[model samples]
Target chain A: MYDYSSRPSRLPLPVDERMASADIDLGQRKSIYRSLQELRQFEKRAHDLFLQNLVKGTTHLSLGMEAVAAGFGAAMRPDDYTFATYRGHAHALARGMEMGPAMAELLGRSNGVLGGKGGSMHLTDVSRGMMGSYAIIGAHLCIANGAAWSAQMRGSGQVTVCFFGDGTTNIGAFHEALNMAKVWQLPVVFVCENNLYMEYTPIDLITAVPHPAADRAASYGLESVIVDGNDPDAVYLAAGKAIGRAREGGGPALIEATTYRTGGHSRADPAKYRPLEEVEAWAQRDPIPMYHARLLGLGVAEGELSSIERDVAADVDAATEFAKAGEEPTGEALLTEVYADGSSRWRN
Target chain B: MAELTYREAVAAGIAQEMRRDPSLVMLGEDVAAAGGVFKTTVGLLDEFGPDRVRDTPISEQAILGAAMGASMTGVPVIAEIMFSDFLAVCWDMIANEIAKSRYMTDGQVSFPLVIRTANGGAARFGAQHSQSVENWAMMIPGLKVVAPSTPADTVALMAAAVRDPDPVIFFEHKSLFATKGEVPEVEVVGRLGEASIVREGSDATVAALALMVPRALEAADRLQQEEGISVEVIDVRSLVPLDTKTLLASVEKTSRLFTVEENPRLCGWGAELISIVGEEAFWNLDGPLVRITTPHIPLPAAASLEDLAIPSVDRIYETVKSSLR
Candidate 1:
């Protein structure tokens, strides 16, 4: 049985050590490093847009946690299903969603992927296989399990990637979904973004165990692995193996990616709960700069790295212009798609 | 036409849909080898094989979540929660994910799924096991709610629920499972929002649903015998897209309305029906609208206490008599 009571002293996240000796090829390393840098820039731009009152409602920007999103998104097939949390802009971007429509969605424009209705919390594009972003904390686990089950039923060899936070593991649905996934051997990879804090509460404050993925795997009798989420190579390697195992019918796996949240839980939170020293320490291990250093060490020229940054900046600028010029849905379109078969009583 | 029990009708409805649509799959606790605790899925495994008829763990969230994902992907799914009360465990999926997916996705996806669960009281099962929450589903805009009192209606409505392009909550009353009624030998599919005037009279309109339909008919018989009062019993089978036209026509002829429901008195389906009648046909009403429902308390496990807690033939009769008076 896993011990629940003894609290261990704080330890440095594994990515800190893993980044020093990341054994990735030049081509793969450059690609992974550039992807992390682009995601970071995208989120930072989103933050700036929020500050400028351009992005409406709330955008849960994944400021410091770009490597896990890049790594997991890179490892999965284009047809693989991705069920994401509300802080899913990076996940969507990593899964090949164009920055223009994604930014347009945050702006609640008619040209958005969800036609402006979903805003930030519910971004979906089934054709691209990003099933959607569910705002409810732990609710998508079973639904993603169902997606895996459906693929099994249809003989469609599709794998589902369900992303959630560490706080989600405390929910009853998390236990229920994990147990079912284990029993049924569903083809799903549960990716827990263990950024330490679930909103304001730290993992140790709410959970008995220190590692949520390993603890939950032991409870559900499912296979589990942990990785340094700040290292794109670590996330890519672990998720690649997990997704391959699931696709080959080895059943579901849990991956606990230990990273840190640099931004507030949401748009309005100032993140006063995080200690200044801890934030400063995590800032030293920022995934973007760490990967940038690794790419330079791997013989990628400084000029090429700067070109990647400049290109991403231009891309973010173009995305903003697209969203600002996009249309908003009229009142007539309010009742248009309430029912797939148009059976809503809103229709005359 | 052939006679069948409510259990057989429900099973046949599911089996027929499975046969017609290869993509239709059923999953729930004990629905496979056990054929369901209520035998609602009896002989389904043998006919459809284990792939189509699956036995799930006792996880309501997984059941609903999997059903939502499966339906959105391709196949039409039927997720049978063993009891209607278990819906509370998976209410978020039904209300948030399943019901809202199609609309929230802007019609990019369809949730072709049915949540079939057994409800109602009188078997001494306590409050947790026995509940009539069809009204809770009725309040959701994207969902369709169906309750069948008789086996024939069960066959047609079950088929309709499976065929519906949206999520449907099919509430089957526990007490009515063994009740026999005549159904067609061939397949029957009833449109969801249509109501049936099971019995016709002229004095007052008694709108009842699910298990209350038979009791309402019995009360109508007693009222005709005792006080020469004629009552039209309207089975409001579809609660969400309610057959308000048929109900209002019945109310127009009768000039009085008495709604009977087995759920709690406050905010019940009866209140919605009465409100619709009051709003649309208040000038035709000859008496105040009356609602017959259970008291607002959890049901006890004793037969006497359960009987006292819920609506019954006697309660329906008294409420109707007073409404007519």
Candidate 2:
């Protein structure tokens, strides 16, 4: 229902004027655009699968918050670690997780990303440096510090990027992690995607500060950085700066990207709490179409953008079929991986 | 062999592991320069330097969460949580994150970390500080729970926990910190899930862990000398990866089983053991299985109340003596 060809007229500046100052090259720009498309298509397929009753349990999607994950994922090295929250399908895909395994994971198949043990909330592909997608709020922030500490101890020079929702800023572990990260000078970057709503309620109703993560940055001795989450180039620039500083031992940085989730928090909720005017206003700033128009305005060919979309659609379709074809996890899988010895046996 | 107190052996055990593995790191509140609140981790900072042996703020979640994250990335970490009771504050990190990370990830990323805490009652730190919560860790499926009674076992188990590939919760009894035992001069690593039959007998079998081990030993000696009741005592060291072979064999030989526990009565570690024995060794039992445990109540700071709550040597002796008679 939204217009993809025309740019939003409400913007203060044109797409070229806003993105012209970004330092990213043409190749990186194309890659970020491609990542955005892939994320959007992948999440759409997941939602469709959920409606079809194939994805058991529940899933938290990053439908409109693709730029945050794609931007940070683009800036990160292949070997760098990524810790994200439950709404991590975007982050997982951005880190180069194969769509087949990712979709299979959501479907609870044997060949799923975590072999179906982790289900939808915990999509982990450590091989791709996607360490984990944590379901519990604020827990992975502390865990991210540990990964950064490991890199510091080993002199690996690898930065750890941790992503969470705006809701996490108010949690106790969030403050603890931020304080510890700063005190230790860990090489980590904390990214907060402020999607206006924290599940059913607006973040401002529960949060004390105007900017949840950025306002609290000074409390942890971090610089307050706010970026436009709907703008891929802006997110890329902010993510690159933070990740670069952390990699060079400048310590951790917190970037609060203001975005909006177009869908409900999960498949269960209808998101009826959101006002109609607010939802319509955010739909105009949708990251996918906004970036799509921006790329076209920046001397990109319409055929090239169309080709990328076609490729992403094919990939998503193949991935869906692959997930549908995967075998159910065997009963023996239930008892395995509880310990290092590959068995859950506690007694001899 | 050298005589070392339980507290001293904690440092020695950790220092030994840190020496062997350069990737091994330790962090906790007051654990580095301050040498731990219980003085269990003295000289770690001086030897390992500030980089590896670092002190963290009093954040239990951060301490354990950082340990979990580091271990996932190939660095084995030893985190001290100060007190076993404080684990409740960071229970989400330990229970949901660290314990389930490996299993949830289907073994793609494993957490090779050790969470060593000063556990059990006796210092009269009150209910908040004093608690034998190994049973709390025991109920979790992925954690390996261990409590050592002697200095030698402390050092040995610490070494084993550091070298292990899974997350281990090492509970050191506060009362036994001053208890001295003979530890080998050479590096010694003990296996997990193995119970030590400190004293062997055929009349009755008594199982105890941590601070209860020495008390059970003394009770067994007293029962032999005064009441002429031959009693076998087993140090049921590791709760998870439980040494059921030794325990069931002991029960078969003695035909009577008694558990001396410091945990509260409800859902204590002894309850699990009794259930396992009751199901597996029911025909071998000559009498009903008895458990001497703390009453289902919070520990009080008053010395008299505390003493009456925890099972004493006289209580173990009397319980076993009357049960046998």
TM-score of each: 0.95, 0.97
Which portion of correct inter-chain contacts appears in model 1? 0.67
lDDT of 2 by residue, A212-267 (tens): 99999999888889888888999999988899999999999999998888889998
Name the lDDT value of residue B141 in candidate 2: 90
Residue A8's lDDT within candidate 2 is 26
Q: Report the TM-score of the second chain of model 1 against its true counterpart.
A: 0.99
- Report the lDDT of model 2 for residue B308: 94
Residues A199-246 of candidate 1 have per-residue lDDT tens digits of: 866787889897877776987887667888888888888888999999
Best by TM-score: 2
Provide the lDDT at B278 for model 2.
97
Model 1, B179-270: lDDT tens per residue? 99899989898888898998999999999998899999999999999989999999999986788899999999999999898888779998
Report every candidate's CA lDDT: 0.86, 0.92
lDDT of 2 by residue, B1-325 (tens): 9999999999999999999999899999999999999999899998889999989998888998899999999899999999999999999998999999889989888888999999999888899999989899999999999999999999999999999899999999999999899999999899999999999999999999999999999999999999899999999999988999999999999999999999999999888888989999999989989999999999999999999999999999999999999
The weakest ten consecutive residues by lDDT in model 2 chain B span B102-111
Which ranges in model 2 have alpha carbons more than 4 Å from their true place?
Answer: A1-16
TM-score of chain B of 2: 0.99
